[model samples]
Structures are given as C-alpha cells and as structure tokens.
Target chain A: MEEILSKLYYMTAFSSFTYQVAIMWFIAFLLLYLGIKKEYEPLLLVPIAFGVLLANFPGGEMGVVAAENIALEGGRYKNLFEIAHDHGIMNFLYYGLIKTGFLPPVIFMGVGALTDFGPMLRNLKLAMFGAAAQIGIFAVLLAAVLLGFTLKEAASLGIIGGADGPTAIYTTIKLAPHLLGPIAIAAYSYMALVPVIIPLVANLLMTKKEFEINMRQMDKEFPAKHTIKNIKAVKIIFPIVLGSVTAIFVPSSVPLLGMLLFGNLVKEIGVNTLRLSSAASGGIMNAATIFLGLTVGATMTSEVFLSPKTLGIIVGGFIAFAISIAGGIVAVKIYNLFAKKKINPLVGATGLSAVPMASRVANEMALKYDSTNHILQYCMASNISGVIGSAVAAGVLISFLS
Target chain B: MELFNEAVSIMIVGMLTVFFILFLIVGIGNLIIKLSNKYLPEEVVPVKATISSEPSNNTYAAIKAAIDIATKGKAQVTNITKL
Candidate 1:
C-alpha cells in the first residue's frame, strides 16, 4: 500500500503544488478569462496566462532564475550569457528576448511599419500634447517613491502612464528586472482599457463646448488642404532626419527609436524593400510579441507577483494612466488660453500612446458632444506623437536612474 | 527625503527632455513640410490624358465624347494619353 501511494504521489501535481502555487494557478485562470472572454489584449494576455499556468505546474522550473550569486566576470555586473545558459526553454525565451533587450525594439520596428506620421507633421503643435501627457509618468514616479519603492522600481512603475507596452517592458527590464511582470501587466492592461479610461477622463474634464470645438485643419471648408505631401523624398528624408536627431539627443532611446525609424525607412525606401518590411512587421514581430508575453507572464510566479508591492504597482499604474490624461487635457486648456483657435481638449487625452484606441475614444466623445465634429485626424497627431514622447520619457528614465 | 527629492528632479528633467525632443521634431517636421510645399509643390494635375492607337474605341475618347455632348461643345479633349 505504501509503495502504491508513493507511486501515485509521484504522478500527481498536487503532491508538489503549494497553496501559493494554487493561488497563482487561479490568477492565471483569471488572466485567461480576461483575455479570452473579456477580449482584453488577447494577443498578449492569452499567451501570458498560459505561460503562468505552465510556470506554476509541478517540477519544470519553467521560469527565469532570479538574479542570485553572481561573480561578475567583467565591469562588476552579472553577465547575461552566464545567467541564460543555466535554464530551460522559458528561460531561453526570457533571457534571450527580455534580458538581452532585443524584443521591444523589434516590436517597435513593426509599429513603425504600421504607423503614418502625416497627421502629426501637419499639426506640429499637437505634438506638445503628447509630450505633456508624459507628466503622468513622472507624477507616478513621485507617488511610487512616496510609497517606498526604490527609484528604479518607481521609474518602472511610472512608465506605465505612457501607455506604451514595449517602452514599459524595456524600461522595466533595464531598471528593475524583478518588477518586469507586474509592470508589463499593468502597462498592457491599462493600454487595453484605453477605450474605457480615456472617455471616462475626457467626459469628466472637457465641457460640451470643448468637445464641440472643430479642429480647423480637419475642416473641409478650410482651403489650405493640409494633406501629407505625397513626395517620396519627404518620406525618405523624414525618418532619417528624425532618427538622427533622436540618436544625437537621447542615445538611450536609439535602440527603440532607431529600430522604429529603420523599419519606417525600409518601408518608405520603396518596392525594393517591400518584402523585408512585410516580414519584419508580420512574421518576426508576431514571434517576438508571443515570446515577450509568455515569458513576462511566466515571470509572474506566485512568489514574485503576490507580494504587497504588487498592489502598489497596480494602484500606481492606474494613477499614472489617469494623471497623464489629465495632464494632456490641462495642457490643451492652457494652450487654448494663448491660441487664436482652440483645439478640442479630448485630443489631448489621446496623447497617451495607446494609438488608435485612445484617439478613437477621443473621437467617440467628440461625436457624442457634437455629431459633426470629426477630430480623429487631429487626435491622431497627438496619438502618434505620444509614441515618440513615451520613448523619450523611457530614455530619460534610463539615463537618469539606470 | 532624498528619494523624494530625487523623484522630483527626475520628474522635472524627464518631462523637460521629452518635451524638448518632441518639440524639436515638430519644428523640424513642420519646417520640412513647409519647405517642400513652397519649393516642390504637387503639380496641379487638371486631367489625365489617354493615348490609344484607336482613339474612337478607347474609354477615354468615349468619356470625352460624353463630356463634350453634355457640355454642348463648351469643353474639348485636347489630349488623350493612356494611363
């Protein structure tokens, strides 16, 4: 009977599963439910939730080993190569993609392929709103510090405000690798909630008059015809100039912004590189995102994710997102005080880097207030600029804290 | 207290850096657009010309003929070139 019991015990996951592991399994199920049923960031969340489940299962140790006993071979820092060599497939994905800091920039390259800077170029002033929205990142940083997180942890937590998932992940990995799971989850969750959160903030802040303010450039009656120059020269020159300037100013951002501009250059350089553009944006990008989501989720083992700090991260993330929207709206209001033509304050709200979602929500709110006011084009200017602004903010944090 | 002070400084510097860089891009992007618009504006393409060996059988000629009739000879097809 004892021999039979021993054999059964060896076969069962319960024999090794702790209560904390059980709780983690439940949390993973919750993430899966949110991803599949609620349809919140399903592309990322589904893989992440599955990874969490796998990580918690019996004896595989399907997670990156935490930073421990490391005799530095060079420069007093642990060698990533040594750390990566010690683990399984999940660790390979984690260290190879996340630790080496390769995946975020790769994803940014794909984003560049899909993005158009025409709207932002047309409304140059709207880009300021994108910059203003970054205030939430810093605001949350202060809040996190007040709450007792280290400066690096606070910075990582604060970046969730930018609403840019790749930047959040990249910054967190660099500054505080241990906080990567919660920070990534917070960033992506709030990003997926853009349609909900933006409107809530916009409605609370902007009056009907502000929403009714029709953006001039979008007005058909305005004869200036603020369309993007279809010249291939402009397309070729813009990315090169932007990339060069970004690299010169913020070398830290070069990895993310450089790849972004490179991908855009490849697309714009013409039909000769069309295949390359398609592959970068399609196949390679998808692969990186899958691995990124899964490994990040797997890192959220019970011991790492269930701490008191996790709650602080969640609350801090929400504050960051909310305050960023408020900052944008406030900036627009201040701009209106000085400008001849007033922009819709809701456009400022879309300054968060959630892209079309934040901009679309702004448009929806505009339409609600005045059926004729179409500010999506104007809103997109701020939306795309927010991407750049967030990258710059990440660079600043990396430069200062790291 | 030191952490608080550091966080404040980070907030100030980070926001300023982001704004400065983006503002520079905006200024440069706008300047480029304005310069391109001024120096190398898009050509004012009134109508595309159609070229065909058999002008009467071509779609352009048929459209031209329809336009001529509709306008009562007020308009004429000066050139027809294939797209």
Candidate 2:
C-alpha cells in the first residue's frame, strides 16, 4: 500500500511541483486569459499559452531542451530519433521545425499572398518612412548591448521593434535561438498592442493640425503627373522586380523575402496560380503558425524564462516599439518642413509591420481630428512598405551578427 | 568600444541599404508605370448605343410623368434628347 501510494504521487506530478513551475503556470494562464477573454491575437496566443501550460506540467517532460543543455548532458548532439525518444514530441517539433528555422519563412510566404502592394505602389514616396521606422531596431540593439547582452542576443531582442513576429522569430532562430521564447513573446505582444501604442505615441508627437492634414485634399491640390494606366501589369511586375533588386543587394534576406515575393507573384498571377496562392495563405500558413507558436511557447520552460534577461527584453521591447513609431513620425515631420505637399504624421505612425491594424489606428485617429480625413489608403502605403523594410532590416542584422 | 563601433556601422549601413533599395523600387516603379501607360493603357470599353431613334411625343410625355412622380413634383424635365 505504501509503495503504491508513492508511485501514484510521483505519477500525478504532485510530488514534483515547484514554485517556478507554479509561476510559469500563472504566466501561462494570464496569457490564456488575454488570448481568450480579451481577444488579443487569439489565434496565436491561444496555441502559445496552451504550449506553455503543457511545458510546465512538472513531470510531463514536454518542455523543449535547449541544444546546449542536450550537448552538455550527453557530451554530444543527439539525433532526431533519440531526442524524440528521450524528451518527447514537443522537443521533436521544436528541433525539427522551429530550431531548423524553417517555419518563419513559410509563414512569410503566406503573408505575401495575403498582402496587396497597391497602396505602397501608388504612393511610393511614403515608403521612405517605412525605412525610417527601422531605426528602432538598431537603437534597441545598441541599448541591449550596453545592458550586457551579447551582440547576437541584442540583435534578436532589438528586432522586436520591427513589429513583425516572423521576422523577430527568424532573426532569433538564426542569431540566438535560446532567446527565441522571450523575443517572440515581446514581438507578438507589442504587435497585438498596436492599437494602444500607435495612438499613445501619435498623440504625444502629432498636433491636431498634423492629424487633420488630409491626404485626399493634398492629392487634389497637387495631383500626380503620372498615373498608372495598366495597374494590373505593374502589380504583376512589381514582386518580380523588387525581389530581384532586394536579392541582389541583400542576399542573406532571400529565404524570407524571396518566399514572400514568390507568394506575391503566385497571387498576382490571378486565376492561373489561385491554387498555389490559396494553399500558401490558407492551409500551409495555418499549419506553420500552429507549429511555430506551439514549439516556440514550449521553449519557455520555467528555468529558461525565469531570468533577469526576460525582464530586460520586456522593457527594451516597449522602448523599441515607441522609438519605431516616433522615428516614422519625426521623419515625416521633417519632410513636412520642406515638401510642398504635407503628409499626415498619422500616416508615418503606421510605418510599422503590424499591417492593417496600424493603418486602421492611424485612420481612426485621423477621423477623430477631421471627419472627412480618411487616410486608410495612404497609411496602407507606408504600412505595406514597412513589411518589406522590416524584413530587409532583419536580413541586415542576420548578415552582420550571425 | 569595438561592439559600439560595429553597432554604429550596422545602423548606418542597414538604414542606407534599406533607403537605397526602396528608392530604386520607386524609380523602377515609375518607369514601369510610364512604359505601361505608353504601351498598354487601360482598354476603354466602348458603350453600346441604347437608343438608336428619336422618342415620340407620347414616349417623352410618359418619361416626364415618371420622373415627376419619382421626384414628387420637386423636379421638372426641361429638355429631352435622343441618341
């Protein structure tokens, strides 16, 4: 009877409970609440939070072991079969898909399929603000390095400023895979908070007059001399041309950018490549996101995540977010100083890779100032360019650090 | 100090490269638009003629009556022409 009781207690995980495990559980539950109750990036957060729960189940042995831990334990690297047999399925998925740095680019392909470059293509000048926003990445990199993180780790942490999850995850996977858990969480959390953050910074920097700067009125006053006659032809040609140019300059960015352009190409081809485009944006992308969220979340085991560095990352990420938004706004304000046709500072604020959310927030803010000022299209011009800009920035960081 | 220097260099190079690439895109994008406009301008779909003959007095009166009813006597049909 005594032996049986001991075995039952051991099997139930009650005997293995620790304060760290309990703390991880609390964090996981908080994320779950945020995901479900508040609808904060529910699709990703739900899976990730659930993954956290699974990883912290004490005796479950489901958490992903870091490569260094595995090497240190066994005095050598283990094969996939051995890893699966020893550590379970979570480790298998992590090492196989997430650690191999395969899923982020696949997700990027889907993003490209869903994206339309029409807005950016129409207002090409606004694309410069997208580049300006990338200043946050380097700024945070410097800060993180000063705070004692290695260059690679700092780069991973800094990329949270890009406001892109896949870009952050991809860079972290390449540079400092160990920091993947915290970096991804920070990136996605800040992205989900785009609505709150954009207004917070825009309100701080932009005046009522700047908010009321109507893009449509400006366009009527100074109409573009050259209008795209065959927009369809240009749309089809754009991905091809931009892909070649970007690849020529930043060859390291090919995996993420190349896949994105390929997906866009398939989408632009219309009915002919409809199947490929749908597959990329639908099933393939969904599956990749699930694996990515789960595997990445599983990496946030109690021992790995309960560090001073995680706190630093959380703080640094917010600074990065604020700085990126400010960089774009300041750039536009500087442009407004000289340019005859002034752009809404709100349009510049949307120059982060949070997609339609950033643009929508800017548009809503614009409408608040002037009912007739609908700047969604103009904001999209900068917002879409931001996606490309962040990816390029990620590539540069990868090339420099890794 | 070396790390700081490397970080600064990265900042300069990364920003410049991003700006340069996007600038090139803007230039090429304009070129593409110009070429397409010159060669493959949007095909103007010709509108088919709906009315080939003049309307009779009775037909014009009927149309005027319909408009007057729809507008509740607020509008008047001043002129009538046929294509």
Candidate 3:
C-alpha cells in the first residue's frame, strides 16, 4: 500500500508545483483572456499563450531549457538529436528555428508579399516621417543604457520601439537572446494596441486644427507637379531598385529587408511567380509564425519572466511607442512651419510599422475632427516606409552592437 | 559616459544613414516614374464602337418591364437612348 501510494504521488504533478509556476499560469491565462475575449492579435497571442501554458506545467519538461542547463558534463553543448531526446519538443523547436534566427526573415517574406508599395510610391515625400519616427528607437536605447543595461541588451530593449516584430526578434536573437521573450511580448502587445496608442499620442501632440487638416483639399489646391504615368511598371521596378540601395547601405539588414523585397517582387511579377508568392505568404509564413510564437512563449518560463527587468521592458516599451508617435507628429509640424502645402499631422502619427491598422486609426481620428478627411492613402505612404525605416535601424544596431 | 557617447554617435549615424538611403530611393523613384512616363506610357486599349440605331419596340417594352419589376413600380423609364 505504501509503494502504491508513492507511485500515485509520482504520477501526479502536485508534488512538483511551485508558486512561480502558479504565477506563470496566471500570466498565461491573462494573455489567453486578452487574445480570446478582447481579440488582441489572437492569431499570435493564442499560440503564444498556449505555449506559455505548456511550458509552466509542473514536471512537464516541455519548456525551453537554457544553454547552461543543457550543457554536458564535458562542458560541450548537446547536439540537436540529444536535445530532442532529453528536453521534449519545445526546446528542439527553439534550437532548430528561433535560436538559429531563421524564422523572422521568413515571416518578413510573407509580410512583403502582402504589402503594397503603390501608396508610398505616389506620395514619396511623406516617407520621411517614417524615418523620423525611428528616433524613438535610439532615444530608448540611450535611456536603457543609462539605466545600467549593457549596450547589447539596451539595443534589444530599444528595438521594441521600431514597432516591427521580426526586426525586434532578429536584433534580440543576435544581441541579447535571453531577453527575447520580454522584448517580443512587448513588441507584439504594443502593436496590437496601435489603435489606442496612436490616438492617445496624436491627441497629446496635435491640435484640433492639425487634426482637421484635409489632405485631399490640399492636393486639389497644390497638385503634384509630376505624376506617375506607368504605375504598374514603376511598382515592378521599385522593389528591385530599393533592395539594391538598401543592400549597399546596410548589408546587415538584407536578411529581413531583402527577403521582404523578394517577396514583394514575386508578388508583383504576377502569373509566373504566383505559386511561389502564394506559398510564401500562405503556408510558409503560417508555419514560421506558429514556431516563432511557440518557441518565443516557451522561453518565458517562470525563472526568466518573473524579473524586475521584464517590468522595465514593459514600461520602457510604452515610452518608446509614445515617443515614436510624437516624433513623427513633431516632424510634420516642423515641415508645416515652412511648406506651402500643409500635411495632416495624423499622417505623421501613422509612421510606425503596424501598417494598415495605424493608418486606419489615424484616418478614424481625422474623420472625428472633420467628416470629409480621408487620409488612409497618405498615411500608408509613411506606414510602409516605417517598415523599411525600422528594419534599417535594426541593421544599424546589429552592425554597431553585435 | 562612454556608453552614452556611443549611443549618441549611433543615433546620429543611424538616423543619417536611414535618411540618406530613403532619400536616395525617393530620388531614384521619381526618375523611374519620369522615364517610364516618357518611354513606356500606359497602353490605351481601344473601345469597341457601338451602333447608334434605335431599339426595336419589342426590346424597349422588355426594358420597361424589367425596370418596372426591379423598382417595384416606383420608378418610371422616361427615355431610352442607344450609343
């Protein structure tokens, strides 16, 4: 009877349960609630929250193991086969995909295929605001370094300001792998809150007159001197030329930006690369996202996530977000001071890589101030450029720090 | 202090590089638009010509009946013109 009771106890997880694990479960459940009930980036959050749940289960051995924990008696790391045999599946996926820094660029390929550069091409001048918004990244990097984080760790933390997940993950994996969980969480969570954040920051910086600046009316008054005649041909050539220029300037960013441009090229080519484009944006992208989210979530085991640093990242990330929006708005205000054709400051606020959501939010805010103000296309000009800007900024950080 | 200086240098360099690269793209993009416009302008497809003859009474009556049913007798068909 004593032997049987001991066996039963060993079978159950109750003996291995700890308060840290309980706390992790609460966090996981909170993420799940936000994903399901609140519909906050459910595609990513659902997979990630479920992964967190799997990792924190007592005696599961499913969470990603740290490199030190997995070190052999001889001070050598275990090979892939050995890791799979010992640490279950999540660690294997982590080492195979996420740690190798393979999936983020693959995801960027999908993003490129789905993106349209026509709006940006038409309104080329607005793209500068995208570059302006990247100030948040450097500003936060300086702040994080002042707060005692090493330059590498500060780079990873500050990249959450870029508002691009793949860029953030790619930089973090290279510079500070340990902080990947928190940085990625911060990046995606804030991206999901773009609708709320854009309005909040825009309200703070932009006045009622600025909000009511109608882009279409300005266009009518001051029409563009040069107009695109062969837009389709220009679209086909833009990605190739931009790719070459980016590769020349920032070779390090090619992994993410190059793949994005290639995806866009394949998408633009039409008929010939249709199958390839579809596979990239559809199957390959979905698989990479799943693995990326799961492995990222699995990295957030109790010992890693329950730290004062995570708190710092959360707060610093919000400041970065608010500052980036403000930076774009301020840039527009400065330009408005001199330019004859004034731009809507709301267009500047959409200068983050959240893409259409940021543009839509900015447009909605404009409509509230003036019913006829539709600036979605104008906002997209900067929004698309923001993707490139953030990627370039990430490359600059990697080149300098790593 | 060294770290702060490094951060500041990176900021200046990074922002400058980003602006330079994007500015180059804008310049090249405008050039492409101009060249394409002058050289490979959009090909205008010719529209098919339509006959100017009037519709027969049977066709006109059919059109009137269709509109009557579609509008639930609310709208009247004032005139029918052919191109």
TM-score of each: 0.89, 0.91, 0.92
- Let me know the TM-score candidate 1 reaches against the reference structure: 0.89
Ranked candidates (TM-score, high to low): 3, 2, 1
Residues A1-402, candidate 2, lDDT per residue (tens digit)?
Answer: 999998898889888899999999999999999899988888788888888899999878889897874464547677788889988999989988988889999999999999998998899889889888888998999998889988899889889999999999999999999888888888988999999999999999988889889999999999998888878888888899889988999998899999999999899999999999999999999999999998888999999999999999999999998999999999999999999999999888888889989999999999998999999999999898888889999999999888
Candidate 1 lDDT over A1-402, as tens digits, reads: 999999998888768889999998898899899999999999998988888888888687686567553335554644556555556677767876788899999999999888877777767778889999999999999988988999999999999999999999999999999999888888888888988888788779888778788876335444343555646666677899999888989999999999988888888887999998998889989998899998998888888989999999999999999999999999999999987667889989989899888888888888887787888888999999999999999999999989
DockQ of each: 0.47, 0.48, 0.56
- Find the candidate with the highest lDDT and give its number: 3
* Candidate 3 ranges beyond 4 A from true positions: A69-77, B49-83
Per-residue lDDT of A306 in model 2: 98
What are the clashing pairs of model 2? none
Return the lDDT, model 2, position A355: 93
List clash counts for every candidate, in order.
6, 0, 0
Better of 1 and 3 by DockQ: 3
Candidate 3 per-residue C-alpha lDDT over A232-270 given as tens digits, one digit per residue, 9 for 90 to 100: 899899899989988988999999999999999999998
User: Regarding DockQ, does 2 or 3 come out ahead?
Assistant: 3
- Candidate 1 recovers a fraction of native contacts equal to 0.78
Worst 10 residues of 1 chain B by lDDT: B48-57
Error of 2 at A289 (Å): 1.1
